[model samples]
Structures are given as C-alpha cells and as structure tokens.
Target: MTAIGIYGSAGRMGRAIATIVETEGADVAGGVDAGGDPTALAHDADVLVDFSTPAALESHLAAAVAARTPIVIGTTGLNATHHALIDRAAGSVAVLQTGNTSLGVTLLSILVREAAQRLGPEWDIEIVEMHHRHKVDAPSGTALLLGESAAQGRGTTLGEERVDSRAGLVGARTEGTIGFASLRGGSVVGDHMVVFAGEGERIELGHRGEDRTIFARGAVKAAMWLADKPAGRYGMTEVLGL
Candidate 1:
C-alpha cells in the first residue's frame, strides 16, 4: 500500500486524514506540524497531504519537489504567489490543490458551470458561502472555485468580471459580473450556493458540508490517485471523474 504523510498532523484536518487513512488500511509514513521538518516527512512518504498554513507552503512544495513525492494541498487562503509556487512545483512532481475537496463540491462546480453556460447573460451570477467562525479568509476558496467555473462556462475569465464584496450603497449589480458574499460564524464546516437570477426567476445550486470528514476522505482519495501520476497540477474533478 502507498505510504501517506500529513503536513499539519496536529490540526483537525490532519488528524481527520490520519484517522481515515488508518481505517482504510493505509500506511502513514509520518506527519508534520509547527516546527516539524516537512522535508524529512516528505522524504519518508510516497505522497503528502497539506492542510497546513500558507506561510509553510513554500517549504512544503520545496520538500515535495526534492523528494519527488506527489502532494495534495487542501490549504485555503492562498494568493497568486502561492499559486505561482504550485505551478512551478508541478513541473517536478504531481500536485493536486483545491479549495474544497468534497466530491459533492466537485460536481457542484460542474453543475454551476453548465448552468452558467445554458443561461444567457441576462442571468446575474451571485455566489454565497459560509464557513466556521474560526475561518480566517473572506469569500472562502471554494467560493472562488465556483466563481471560476461560472466564468469559464460564460467564456470569460473570473478576473475580468468578479466582485468580491459590496458596501456603502453599492451601485446596481454589473451585468456579466460574478458577485460573491461570505459569512463566517458558528461551526459550519462549509456551505455554498450559486444563484442565477434572471428577470422572472432564479436558479440556485448549492452544497453543504456537515463535517470535516468529507474533506478528509476526499483528500485521501486525491492523494491515492495522485501517487502514481506524472508531474503536473490536478483538481478534484480529475480525482472524482467529474
């Protein structure tokens, strides 16, 4: 069996992945947390799953590339710099990164894209997402992923027409622009809804993550699928065949 490693082993996500990995009869080479050596852990495992912090992303990717070990990145709050790093690392090792790893969210993205395509520009796209109170980032990564899907379906790039927030008597919603709203409170694992509002009606597509276990399961599955793949970047859609 493939040996798996966890980068944020002491955290909730790391523990969850480890628990499920054991239950699935898989081998855990080791895990790394704050102050731990990721390069050492990467060297010992066949694959790595990172639920660690953005500050550690560079070191983690370097370690993965050096060890030639594939990695699944489930960390959120990443920026362009982080993505640039992932893109570079993918040249040396297989790297699968996603905002949300749940299979349902993967399919939800596909459906959101299709809906955006089928509907005309008359339909205004708005995405709302909510996460746990402890969550740091606004407009969770999954929300952006769905926004990307919506943009792709409309044959436009998200950066071209994406609005992250609204305040102070904002003007009317721009046509063809994707709007995002974020809510953080309680212990909501995750919840997302894509609303397509037209003149006479509206269509809403959504997904609710009741627990972190779903993300952990998907990360493990993605890690397994990535273990033997060639050097490149990947997503949950490839893992779930969505």
Candidate 2:
C-alpha cells in the first residue's frame, strides 16, 4: 500500500484528503500542520499531498526534494514566486500543482480552452466564480485556471490577456481580453462559469462543486499516480491522461 503524508493536516481539504486516503486503499503515513516537522513527514511517506498555505510552500517543497518523494500541491492563493519554486523543485522530484484538484474542474478547463480557440475575438470572454465566504482569495485560483485555458486557446498567455478588475469609467470591455469576476457567499463549495459573447449568440462552459470530496479524491488519485514517476512538473490533465 502507498504511504501518503498530508501537509496542512488541520485544514478542511487536508482533513478531507486524509479521510479519502484509506478508502482509496492507501495509508496515511503521517501529517504535519503549521510549525510541525515537514522534513520528518516527508521522509516517512512514499508521497506527499499539500493543501497548506502559500507562506510555507517553499519549506515543504525543499523537504520533498530532500526526501526524494513526489508531492501533489492543491494549495490556492499562490503567486508567481511560488510557481517558480515548484518549477525548481520539479527538477529534483515529481511535483504536480494545480489551482483546483477536482477532476470535473480539470475537464472544464480543457473545454474552456477549446471553446476559446474556436471562437473569434469578437466573442468577448468573461469568467465568473463563487466560493465560500471564508475563502480569502479574490478571483479564486480556479477562475485563473480557466482564464489560462481561454488564453491558451487564443494563442496568448493569461498574464497578457487577463483583466481581473474593472470599476467605474472602465469605459468599454476590451476585445480579446479575458475578464474575471469573483463572488463570495454562504456555504458555496465552488462555482465557475465562462461566458463567450458574440453578436447573436453566447457560449457558456461551467462546473459546480456540490461537495469537497471530489477534490480530495482527485488529489489522492494524483498522489498515487505520481508516487513512482520520475522528477518533473505535472498537472491533473496528465493524471487523467487527457
């Protein structure tokens, strides 16, 4: 049986992954939360899954590399520096990082890219997402993930095409730009919809998270799939063979 370690074991996603591990026929070798010994946990497990804060990601990645163990990162609210760290770690150990780990969200991303690719720039693209009130990040990671997909379809990058904010006097929506709007409210697990507006018709692609288990299950599946892989960066698409 695969022995998995959980970082950020006290958080909701951490707890969820722990519960699903055994059901998937894997063993929870150990877990570490804030201020805990990550190096020890990494050394003891065959693979590691992180849903921890971005503040601690560097240390966790270092531990994974030192132990030569694979890690799956589902942590949200990350910035460019964190991605660079993941890229660096991937050189020494297998690393799979994603905005969201739910398989449904992964498929939705694929579809969003395809739609944007086929549609013309006249079809203004907009992305909207809603998560629980407790969530702190604006334009939730999943929202950005979808934006990246649409940008990819247009043969551009999200950094160049993404427009996360628009206020008064934001005169007119720019053509070919991908817009984002984030909503927060009570108990919403997650919801994302991408809209492509044209002259007479519009296309919408979306995904709703009714529960957290799907993400937990998907993270576990990624961890299992990554355990024996060679050092490199990966994503859920590779996990699902998409």
Candidate 3:
C-alpha cells in the first residue's frame, strides 16, 4: 500500500485528497497544514501531495527533498522562481506538477493544441476560465496552461503574444494574439474554454469540472505513479500517458 502525506490538509483541495486517499485503500501517513510542520509529516510518508498556496511551495519542496519523498503538486500561481525551485528539487526527488488535475481538462489541452496547429495563425485563439469566488488568482492556472498549449502549437511563446483581456476603448482584436478572460462566481467548481475564431467558422474546446474530487483523485493517482519513478520532473500529460 502507498503511504501518503498531504500538505495544506485543512484547505478544500487538501481535505478532498485526504478523503480520496483513505477511500482508495491507501495509507494516510500524516498531513501538515499552514500551522504544522511539513517536514515532520513528510518523514512518515513515501509520497507528499501538495494543494497549498504559492507562498508555502518552497518550504513544502524543501521538506519533500529532505525526507527523500516523491511529491505531486497541484497548486497553481507559480512564477519563474517556483519553476526554478521545482527544477532544483527534481534533482533529488521525483516531482509531478499540474495546473489542473482533471483527466478531461488534460485531454482538452491536447485538443486545443491540435486546433491551434491545424487552424494556423489566421485564426485567433482565446481562453476563458472560471472558478469559485474564493479563488485568489485572476486567470486560473488551467487557463494559462491551455494558453501555453495553443501557443506552443503555433510555434510561439505565450509571453510574446498574450492579451489578458480588453477594456473600454479597446481597438480591434490583434491577429496572432492569444487572449485570456477569467470569471469568478458562486461555487463554480471549474470551467475552461478555448475558442478559435476565423473568417467563416469558430471552434471551441472545453472542459467542466463539477467536483473537486476529480482533482483529488488525479493527485492521488499521480502520487502513486511517481513513487516508483526515478528522480525527475513530470506533468499530468505524463501521468495520464497523453
């Protein structure tokens, strides 16, 4: 049986992970919240799952490394520094990270990439995402991941051509630009849509997550999968064999 340690165990996603681990016949070694010690918790488990905030990422990664435990991270809102830290830690332990853990969302990203590649630069791409009102990030990490997939298919970098949104007095939409729009409202689990618009036709690829447990299940799956792999960095695409 897999031994699991959960970080941010008090939060919504954390609790969901804990529930899934318990129900799946896996061992819940221990957990750590904001007020607890992750290093101590990690020491008792084979793999650590993190659904915490960006502020806690560094410490969590450090704890996992010190304990020589694998980690599956589902937290979003990462910047260059976080990527750097993950890369550093991957040298010592297996690490899997994903912006969205739903299997459907991962498939949606692949479809978005295919559409971008087939439609060419003439068709503009836009990503729209929504989450619960309590979400702190403006554009959900899932939206950015979808945007990156589209940008990659077009052979360009996301940063070079991202249009977050348009406001009053905005001019015509820019060609070859990928736009992102975010919405937050009452208890929305998660929603993402990638729109491709051209002269005569439009195509939309989307995914809707009705429950947080989809993510929790995926994270646990990732933790179990990463436990046997050699030290390296991985994503949900690898986890799902996309």
Q: What TM-score goes with each of the models?
A: 0.98, 0.98, 0.97
In model 3, the clashing pairs are none
- lDDT (tens digit, per residue) of candidate 2 on 77-114: 99999999999999999999999999999999999999
Show pairs that collide, candidate 1. Answer: none
> Residue 12 of model 2: what lDDT?
92
Using lDDT as the measure, what is the rank order of every candidate, best first?
A: 2, 1, 3
Please give the range of 10 consecutive residues that has the lowest summed lDDT in model 3: 22-31
Compare the candidates by lDDT and give the number of the best one. Answer: 2
Per candidate, the number of residue pairs that clash is: 0, 0, 0
Model 1, span 84-164: residue lDDT tens: 999999999999999888989999999999999999678999999998899998889899999999999999999998998
lDDT of each: 0.93, 0.94, 0.89
Worst 10 residues of 1 by lDDT: 19-28
Query: By the lDDT metric, which is better: model 1 or model 2?
Result: 2
Q: Give candidate 1's whole-model lDDT.
A: 0.93
Worst 10-residue lDDT window, candidate 2: 164-173
lDDT of 3 at 73: 87
